[model samples]
Target: MGGYVRATPMAVQADEGVPPSTSLPDIGAASFGAGDVTVETVHLPDDRVQITNTAAYPWRVHCSLHVTAADNSEWIGTGWFIGPHTLITAGHVVCIKHSGVPGRDGWVRSIRVMPGRNGATLPYGSVTSTNFWSVKGWFESGDQNYDYGAIIIPTELGSNTGWFGFGNWSDAELLSTVGNISGYPGDKPAGTQWYAARGISSVNALKVHYDIDTAGGQSGSAVYRVLNGNRYGFAVHAYGGATTNSGTRITRQVYDNFVAWKA
Candidate 1:
């Protein structure tokens, strides 16, 4: 609870200081229900973002992204289209302090949505969120599982152009089944372009943990799966209290609120 703060929007100054780097021990992989998810391995340099995928079955979906404060700043994140122009991501990614100010000119630099792996440059379209929200409990409790946020994408994504719809929230019974997940880990310098992990839990809770690997830059990555023969995004990366090498659970929370916003 040392680094805990309310998940509320506050003005921020440009971050002129170099981003600090911390290395945590890698945990081991986890096993799950059969044939539901398949992970694709990806490697990265010692100093890049890390990520893993698990949604085994393929249902076509696109990723949502935003620009970094510094040009070429290696800030990367993961997101999926929920509606025509609306994409969902961890609010922290799209919203950052400009410098170190508490409530100043913090703004989203840029945002983009890509259709497949290896398409970071080609933003299906970019937009900003008019409003953002997070659970008060998540902020006060310091539980990574409850961390959530949404973006109110621009006109371009809403008009049958670049957006994708969301999937219904499956019960704990459904999440206990198998599923695959994907995301772009900005920390990874190479290996596979998109970090993919397989066989993750689909349960709904404040802390639905998984064995999928990820790192700091992957904070906003998506956790999804193929249910009922359709691919749908259901969650986003909040934080990791454990590691893949240590058999740690990649903590996440379902995007129920965002889905409700779309409906």
Candidate 2:
């Protein structure tokens, strides 16, 4: 018999550097899942160290964020892949809050995700997406405690690059663990990635506070801990406070949501 080939459905990906639409036809605030500044909440003597070699594992997993809000206002934040095509960030990153104008207060217009991006250099390239998701607590009320969300890209960009495993940890476990945060900070050069690690300062039902240095654009960065050589996320970085920055803890409910969204 002559050689034959069976066609298999393959994931179609845009060419490297194919940027997302600069302006999505106004979707209006109602038709969205929605909704920063480029201010990191870093403490005095910023301890964040830049990751110049963004092509490596873990570091490469970090992404620089550029969001176009529903009101067409632009901001910067950070996000990380947790699944083949899913990236998690602050709920505010997906849905703008207050914005002073209620009419422009829902989901963001679009986002351009650059994984493992180095300053002026895209080691892993970039993709623009309009798909986003957030919980009712945030989507409806814009609660800071509920400020965490996911961005789904059409391509499986994480397959080759890999992702982080997120889980719910007890207060005891979290308090005893040192959390890690790495992302693009506004205080640093545009597109460059930075990192910090510190013992978790506090943990509550809704938030995990840490002394890890982070600036404005670092929101949505994973607050993860390494266990036996594996990295597992315990929270979703969200707010910066005067004493300590914090994240939305990955409670059972949030973990369930993440699993559901990834599926």
Candidate 3:
């Protein structure tokens, strides 16, 4: 259900709250209307560009996540580093719900993180982590408003790969923002990254909607902006639809969670 999800930690196995994956991980988000959750909407002309150089600064900081769900199912999502060992993503990426299956709603078994990965090439190697974190709003109840999380990796890869700084923004401030999203999408060659940028389409108390082009594997990718030469993420990419794509907005509470979780 997510990454840009923070799995900067590797999971050893499915944990007590592991969730099952019945389809694409995107099933765990919210939309403006009752749209199909699994479909990845792209505007005409497909403005997303494939990121070729995996060793660059910010591009290198973004990671591709391969998750093994509690039911032994495999799913792909994206994540970006925020600290030496902390990576952020969508909550459903760590704990899933409403899969309509028995005994499949819980924490994932494992997640393999590959940073700055090009197709068939892993620039910074990889890490498999079991350590995951989410809030009660998501785990105890499948609340879309709280659908974001993190992963803690054993290694301090972010020191080398570096990371993005995220912050909370007021809706008024966001109205004038142009956001960026880049991640490995499942529709392309595996492990490949794609990039897009556009003015934010809309913003709410809990979500930020954009017209940026994205696909399934991009869930949990950072919805960020370059302010004063540094990357500041304001949302965690989550849902997609015919009208727009969205991410969990970095509200004050969500920002505090990142500060507390980042290490």
Candidate 4:
């Protein structure tokens, strides 16, 4: 089970609802095919998205990255800026190379992240990086349980752009009750699959979980719980469990480390 396995692409079923919010592009109609599996956008009149999807108020850093396959083709996942130059992602979305392999180092390249992206094809604000950090101990040894990593953006994301802060690990219940997952699902194509899912705090609270279905491409999405009906990212996409495939969960340890990283 420890051996490298083919990655599964993250996918959300097509939503046939009224459509998405006016703020976001009509991703459901513009991209995904028709099916019974339609994802309701953040703007649903009845659905309350204090933690996960809709914009309760303003916004902050927008995280972005390129997912390259062995064939050289690539897809992208979007994350928000958690710290200055530090963006979090699901470990599986971005590949990890263990030590002792010649020319096989674990890091991210050709990476670009933009803060505060709008409906435009490109980012309204963008930042790129040359260095990244994973859980130091887990990277050295393959540990799926701690599947999280950080990208060191050389540029400053700057204040007033909605840089994020971490929640105290002591309150896991706050995370469990309300939360949401946002990311670019790879199956839909660039600038086409951005979406959000309503989430509930996972049983452990260390990780965030929800009924929002996802596929392989959506691995490293930011999982946040509601604080006063506002979304604050607590975990980066690590992986989903074997049993409950409804959505992916992000662990607390991975999130805590990234929040504490400096320089």
TM-score of each predicted structure versus truth: 0.56, 0.85, 0.87, 0.62
Of 1 and 2, the candidate ranking higher by TM-score: 2
Cα deviation at 85, candidate 1, in Å, is 2.0
lDDT by residue (52-97, candidate 3, tens digit) is: 9988998999998887777776788888999999999888888777
Candidate 3 global TM-score: 0.87
lDDT tens per residue, model 1, 109-200:
44334433333222232343434444443434423334455554435444433343344443654446544455555445421234455455
- Provide the lowest-lDDT 10-residue window in model 1: 24-33
**Which 10-residue span in candidate 4 carries the lowest summed lDDT?**
24-33
Backbone collision tally, model 4: 15
Query: What is the C-alpha lDDT profile of model 4 across 1-263, one tens digit per residue?
Result: 11222222233223222211223222121112232223222222323222222122233454435433233334455556665556666553345444233443344333455444333333335544545555534455545455565655555664435565555444456434545555554444343335454545354533444545444444566666657755566655544333332222344454446655534
Task: Write down the lDDT of every candidate, Cα atoms only.
Answer: 0.41, 0.77, 0.79, 0.44
Q: Deviation in angstroms for 249 in model 3?
A: 0.4
Off by over 4 Å in 2: 1-39
Candidate 3 regions exceeding 4 Å error are 1-35
Span of 10 residues, lowest total lDDT, candidate 2: 1-10
- The reply for model 4, stretches above 4 Å from the true place, is 1-60, 67-73, 93-105, 116-120, 158-160, 169-176, 199-201, 205-208, 241-256
Give the best candidate by TM-score: 3
Cα displacement (angstroms), candidate 1, residue 39, comes to 19
lDDT of 2 by residue, 111-157 (tens): 77899988767777887777788887887776677878888887888
Judged by whole-model lDDT over C-alpha atoms, candidate 1 comes out at 0.41
